[model samples]
Target: MPELPEVETVRRDLHRLLRGQWVKNVSVNKEKMVRGSTSLFKRNLRGLLVQGVKRRGKLLIFSMTDDKSLLVHMKMTGQMIYQSKQTLVGGGHGQPRVKRDELPNKYTHVVIVFGDGARLFFNDMRQFGYMRLVNAKQLEQVVKRFGVEPLSKAFTPDKLRRLVRGRKTSLKNVLLDQRGVAGLGNIYVDELCFLAGVRPMRRADKVTDREIVKLHKAAINVLKRAIAARGTTFNSYRDGLGGEGKFVRMLKVYGRSGKLCVRCKTILKRVKIGGRGTVYCPVCQK
Candidate 1:
């Protein structure tokens, strides 16, 4: 699943490539994954001019002309690839990597042809992704369900404290809840817990104020660094420009279950929190 940093990198890449470009055609091969009838979906998107691309949580919102918005969620194993006469730039899942010469292959479910002879392909091997067209009102309703944007100015330490106040759920659960923190997923949440020196299974309400400050700072720091590096790419993930994220090399806790802790020589441990594998330093993290 593409998290905040990964989604943000895609948003930036698509916004730069698709902005000011007019959609000349739309093709939908997998109708079941789209919102409406295949014909209607194609009609709604065919001639719309893209204003820009924006992201709320894990959703990609493509602002188009005529007050229309195209919302796409690349659930899991989804990739967005943009190809032009001169360039091929994109990022997402890499498994069965979309060959530039053999595009619109077996996995491409949606293809948007632009007026400039360029094309954007949405491919999902598992076919779990979806694309929907909405009016401004619907768009507003969709984005309203998300919680605070962690990269926004609104996510302060006090705000984070208020979110976890009186919550008996594990801190991991609280952070993973999109209603509490919009863009955090299992990977970043585990990393955030390790950075804050807190156990993932700790009750939210038991967190100290000082720990809240550390959590807030860790969230900001990790996100900024991840975005700067594009995102974490393991086997499937990649940046919008089709480059691997450098942050994976900088990771300290996530995916380092049996490794030595960077801060302490103690071996790290992995525990299941909310059914997700969470790794942390038992000696360094509470």
Candidate 2:
């Protein structure tokens, strides 16, 4: 699944390309890929002008005229590709890769046509992604379901401390909770913990105040760097321009289990937390 960085990358590209363009048509190849009535969904999108694209957590919000929006979630194996006569750009899980010539390929479950004949394809190899049509009120409710955006003004050292207070779960699990920290995933949790010199398995309440400050800083630093690098691509991730993220090379312990730690020369170890593989350096993190 594309995390905040990857999703935000896509949102940025799409917002730039799709904004001000009128929806020429809406096609739903797979009914299950859409959340509401297919006809209503198509009706709501047709002819609507895309006002902007916004993201909260991993959800992409396409704001359009008439108080309508498209809420898209590229769950695990989904990809959003935009194509015009002059450009082709997209990003998501890159599995079952799309052949440019054979676009609207078997994996493309949804396609949005713009007034200029450009098209946006929503492809999912595993059919786990979804698109929903929503009104302003519905959009607000959806946004409210997520926690603080790490990049937003609402997230700070004090806010981070409050969010983790009283949590008995491992720091990994606490960070992964979307209700607490909106955009963190397994990859980032491991990296941030390592950067903070803390163990992912440490209990949230067990973390010291000083450690909280470190964690808060590390979280922002890691996320900002990852976003700047376009995000980490491991097997199945691409950026908005159909490019792989360069951040993978900067990863410390996320996928480097059994490797030597850069800081302490200790061997990195991997463990299962909340069913997700987590890697850390025992010596450095201790």
Candidate 3:
């Protein structure tokens, strides 16, 4: 699944290309890829102007001129490709570099036509992604579900401390909960813990005040770096331009379980916390 950075990358790229374009038509090859009534979904999107694109958590919100929005979640193995005469940008999970001609292939599920004849294709190999049309009032209710975005200014050391002050869960599990701090996934969580020198298995309540500050700083730093690198691409994570991100090569512990730790030269160990695979350097993180 595309986390915050990857999803934000797609949101920004889509905003650059699709914003201000009027919807010419809508087509759904697989109706299950859409949520709510299919007829209403098509009806709300056609002729609506795309004002902008926003992202909440891992979902993409398409603000429209008609007081409605298209909420899209690329669950897994999903790809969103925008095509035009001279430019092409595809974002989501699947393929490091997607070709323009290869689009609308077997995975193509939903296609949105623009006034300029450009089309945006939604492809999901696993068929788990879905798009829902929501009204202005409904959009408000949806946005409230997400917690504080770590990349936003609302997230700070004090705020981070307050969120997990009394939590008895492991640090990894606490960080994974979107209700407290949004946008953290397994990949970046491991990196953040490594950067802050905090063990993933430690309880949130047991983390020292200094460690909290470090974790706060580390979270922002890791996320900013990942976004700058266009997000980590391991199996299929891609940017809006169908370009693979460069952060995977910079990962320290996420997938380096049996590898040597960069800081202490000790072999990284992999363990399971909160049922998710976690990697850490035993000698470096305590």
Candidate 4:
């Protein structure tokens, strides 16, 4: 799954390359994954001019000229590749590396052609992603479901405390809950836990005030650094410019299960919490 860093990188790149470009045509090969009526989706998209691109949680919001926005969720295995006459860029999570010759091969399900001759391709090997068009009013209603934007200034210590109050779920689970903290996923959650010296298995209600402050700072720092580096790319994930991220080299304990911890020399441990694989240093993290 492409988490906050990967999604934000895509949003930034797409905004730079796609703003003000008119959608000339729409083609959908896998109809089942599209959310709204196909005809309505195509009609709203065909001639609309893109005003801007923004992201909330993991969703991409493409603001259009007619007050309608295009919402795309690149679920697991989905990739959005953009190509113009002068440049080509994009990559996503879950699919194998996209070969230069193999693009638009079989996984390319949706293609949006622009008036400038540039094309945006939405590819998903698993067919679970979806694209939908919504009016501005409906878009507001949709965004209301998302919780606090973790990167925003509004996410203060009080905000963090309020969300964690009386919650029995593990701290990692609380972070993963979109209704509590939008844009956090398993990968960054693990990194945040390790950075804060908090155990992923620690219950939210049991977190101390000192630990809460550390957790909040850790999340913000990790996200900001990851965004700066573009994003973590293991196999399939890529930035909107089709480049890989440099954050994987900075990772501490996300995937190094048996590796020695950089802090305490203890073998990092792997545990499954909420069905997600979690890694941490036994000595460094509580």
> How do these models rank on TM-score, best leading?
2, 1, 4, 3
Q: Which wins on TM-score, candidate 2 or candidate 3?
A: 2
lDDT of 2: 0.90
In model 1, the worst 10-residue window by lDDT is: 90-99
Cα lDDT tens digits, model 3, 1-286, are 7888888888899999988999999999898999888888898799999999988878899999878989998887788899998888888886434677876888898999999999999998898889999998998898888889998889989988887789898989888888788778889999999999999999989999899999999999999999998888877555777678988899999999999999989999999998899999998899
lDDT (C-alpha) at residue 164 in model 1: 90
| TM-score for each candidate, following the candidate numbering | 0.97, 0.98, 0.96, 0.97
Clashing residue pair totals per candidate (backbone < 3 A): 0, 0, 1, 1
- Model 2, C-alpha of 98: deviation from truth (Å): 2.3
Between candidates 1 and 4, the one scoring higher on lDDT is 1
Deviation of model 2 at 129, angstroms: 1.3
Residue 266 displacement in candidate 4 (angstroms): 0.9
Candidate 1 lDDT by residue in tens digits, 146-187: 999999999999999999999999999999999888989988
Clashing pairs in 1: none
Question: Which parts of model 1 have CA positions greater than 4 angstroms off?
Answer: none
lDDT of 2 by residue, 188-222 (tens): 88999999999999998899999999999999999
Which pairs in model 3 have colliding backbones? 90-240
Q: What are the RMSD figures for all models against the true structure?
A: 1.0, 1.0, 1.4, 1.1
